[model samples]
Target chain A: MGRIEERFTALKKEGRKTFVAYLTAGDPDLETTARLIPALEAAGVDIIEIGVPFSDPTADGPVIQAASQRALKRGATLAKILAMTASLRRTSGIPIVLFGYYNPILSYGPEKFAGEAAASGVDGILVVDLPPEEADELRCYTDPAGLAFITLIAPTTDPVRARKILRRATGFVYYISVTGVTGTAAPRADDVRSDVERLKRMTALPVAVGFGISTPGQAAAIAPLSDGIVVGSALVRLIGEKGTSDDLVPAATSFAGEIRRAIDAACPSQGKK
Target chain B: MIRTQPDRRGHFGIFGGRYAAETLMPALLELETAYRAARRDASFKKEFSFYLHEYAGRETPLYEARRLTETLGGAKIYLKREDMNHTGSHKINNTLGQVLLARRMGKKKVIAETGAGQHGVATATAAALFGMECRIFMGEEDIRRQAHNVFRMKILGAEVTPVDAGTATLKDAMNEAMRDWVSSVRDTFYVIGTTAGPHPYPVMVRDFQSVIGREARRQILKKEGRLPDLLIACVGGGSNALGLFYPFLADPAVAMTGVEAAGKGLDTALHAASITAGRVGVLHGNKTYLLQDEHGQVRDAYAIAAGLDYPGVGPEHAWLHATGRARYVSVTDEEAVEAFVALSRQEGITPALESAHAVAWAMKTAPAMAKDKIAIINLSGRGDKDAETIAESREEKE
Candidate 1:
């Protein structure tokens, strides 16, 4: 099994919900990103989603959009990010997912990207704009490379289409908790709970809720309902604020630790079925 | 045989598809189903035609530009007078059709993205007729440049939201509109203004705007008793060009040219000539030629005409270019300005800056052709909205 599947299996057996932390790969620069990854792992982040910056981030709100601009201006490219991921694999075993738009991968050539990304210890990819109807071009290559093609399920997704989407999904499903762009609006826990329950009944694969998830309180409220929860804009916002400061890594690490504690507190392992 | 394009899934070869986020997927599917049904329903057709004829003033004339022809001293020139439409452009044709669709789908709110604010005004006009709430997203830079059309949109009861991100142009405005649609997909209908965006949109917009070509075909037959040898139109998001070109795809004798905006020059970084100077990539949910860097990041496109200043063209244009069915060329800002002035002086008609690109190309190509050869230029809009920009340019030159 790939690292994403293995990590989920371990977390399920341990009766602990997975905590996925997202950071733009070259926010201030790739060096800061490389340093933050290990620090986040030490602070109990189960998965790290490295955001590859793009010129236009339609699905993201201002925070992540600004983060993308900063990263792009600093000369971030997919090849360099893959190289960084390969280097980080020399020491760390934490599951890593490259999260961004599809154009960069297309520009880099999909066949080559899948091979390089998988060989670089990247476990999965989540392209924000590439829906199931448009995923085949990349999936045909990524599947053979053993890189999980993570699918996103939104609040607007009906059950029929959800099943259609799940048929090709490999890594844990990312459920966008709200109908809006990332980092905007707060999703109510009650609404997410029902959707999560419905998705759970459909697929045995884990469903990790994301989008509009920020506060530890929000993560705690969403923890027990699914296999995992993804924290993106909040951590990205924090990084944007402290990206130039000396305390950037520590601040991000502490933030991840806080979210981890919150999830554990809300859904303790001993109470698992 | 040539007309059978964009298979059921909306791919024109490898160009157009639904590349939107998952949140918008179900909505896109729903829209596709509705649009397909509407295409078959005669009543939907009747209502759309009713609005186009009675409200938007359809059957706009195809006038022989005798002065322009005589001045050029070569090919006979005809202008498909889309500027004579009620909203002073061809945009109303698509907006009227889409607003009717919105009403049929029970959508109470309509949102759109505009560059020169022409589409925004057109959408707002349709929304007012249907009593639906309307909103428009325009680039901050374009909002300033095209303030006249922005005010016109406001007068038509649409909220104008200025997008400040990513060079603050048409692409950024589209990004903002998509974000809004994601949040409000339940009750809102996103009326994409051009022949771009995801699936059904390109096909739907093309179908609605094809009225221009249909009318021109009939009018030309009546006037000249023969089809024009060449068709030319300016391409921004390429709606007008596609509208004029789709009907003539089966006519082997007819030739077509799409004029892109070459801002400063083609060699410079500032230009919107996507097909002329672009790579195949995806942006705004369609795989087409995009003005992007080697690393796949889209670059800002520049043009004196706000309407033509987009980084990407419609997917159908990309297909046409790929198949060599239509020729794509570019006109620089200086050349377009010259055409804009010449047409006003020669024909007493002030063409929109966007349409001036086509006029400029016609000026270059018409003079070299035989006097008996006929050419038709799609005069997509009027220059009333561009008076300020034109004045500013003249002042700078003086």
Candidate 2:
């Protein structure tokens, strides 16, 4: 286990929830993306998920979909993502998880992908489409290389299902906050709160909440209940509006700082990792 | 011994894997477990046989084509009339079994990808029979070439999604089907229309399609009092050929020939000749003989029959060719067109352009042999869709 798993374990023990942020690498440009990493770390995000753009992303929302389209237009690929990961690893040793669809990896082959990903300083991989059952087939090939395979648990999951997922889950569990599509934000936080509590009772695995979670108000509200609040589309929207690739460091730093403050205010005890 | 590949994933000597999106993991597990149980159950096999015989119009004639044999001027030619099947193609044989398997596994939707649209039609037919929702993904180019199939599919209540990427043909359509499978794996069963894809698919499809060879064995023995000297079928993705060859594989007396499409002759990207000129590579799911660049990325390919326009031959074909039990050959699109014209006018049966490749080879090879040398060819599909193209090509020649 890397910093991603280790710190999350400690936080779960100390009764603190974790907050993770997702960003597409080289969405607008490589140089600007080069700046966003440490800003996220400084912003009090427990874990970082870097989106590896695939041409066919079947499960992505409109914002992530748009981010992927932009990245592909700028000629993004597995090789390009590895380069970004290599660069980002220099200063920040925060747990970096890669969230990608499985086709690109299939095209790349399993052995080669595992080797490349491990060498590139990636701690874990959460392929949205690859669930625990399929990951079991790949575990022999990827696990030897020390790459943690994280599983996603949906709201539709029952207790037996959650336990099955928890047993197979390697890193923290990513609980999809709602039932429908990825981008559509929640209308009510009550169902989400109850679901989180249910999940908390079920597994010892650190639970990170994502999908349609945007505003800091949402993050602050979600922070008390869940171990991590994963804010993607909103931060992406900000990056699309206010940031440029040439200087994404300042953009990410500022955006992450705001989320960090919100999280800190909600929890208060856990400050300065 | 049924060639037990128990421990291995999909290596009939190096092929097959779970090369798909991760979301499909849970669903594929469900199917794999169900298939394992289903294959072992006598009731499943009994039901499959019952469906094959009564519903699919199986036991299709293995007729002695006296006219074609006389015209070729040599050994006799027997035709395995798969065209007489319910949907006018051998594609239905596999689809029927797969749909039943899906239904047994409690899935509601059966999705498929097609190029010439035969598989789509067959899948739609099966889905309708099983009362399952059907979604067929077809290449945009194919939708134009085989427009009637599109309308038929619509009437059959199948949602046809046109795929337009990477040459806009069968391969792209397959990619789209897989993308759909990723999300809908919960209630959807992907009826992979051929003896291709991952381990269990190739294994299961081959078993389903092997009915052709099984029937041919009994029919040939009943008619000729002995085994045929040779067997042949065109090899697009090699399903129909595998169907015929698999039953007679251990019969050393029978020589098998799998013909590949030599679209405009075998010059790099201009052909679909897999075993003849292809290097080992992976596509769809299984690693086999593929027409790939140095980067191993699949290259564009051509074929007269839209059905045979694929760059990679199925992994099982590669295995058969390597083991020397199956001899592989190539027939150019021109030669196939000529054979298509010859067979139609003489035998009065229009053959699919894909199947015509095998027919053309039999026309050539059957003539070179001495009298009494028996040969059989699988007329894998009906050729009504080719009438327009055949007429246009003839008009140009005139």
Per-residue lDDT tens digits of candidate 2, residues B277-388? Answer: 8877656666678776543446666787888878887777888887777899999988999989888888888888888998999998999987889999999998988776
Cα lDDT computed for each candidate against the true fold: 0.94, 0.79
Clashing pairs in 1: none
Lowest-lDDT window of 10 residues in candidate 1 chain A? A264-273
DockQ for each of the predicted structures, in order? 0.90, 0.17
TM-score (C-alpha, index-matched) for candidate 2: 0.80
- TM-score of chain B, candidates 1 onward in order: 0.99, 0.96
Worst 10 residues of 1 chain B by lDDT: B1-10
Interface RMSD of 2: 5.1
Which regions of candidate 1 deviate over 4 angstroms?
Answer: A270-273
Please name the candidate that would achieve the greatest DockQ relative to the true structure: 1
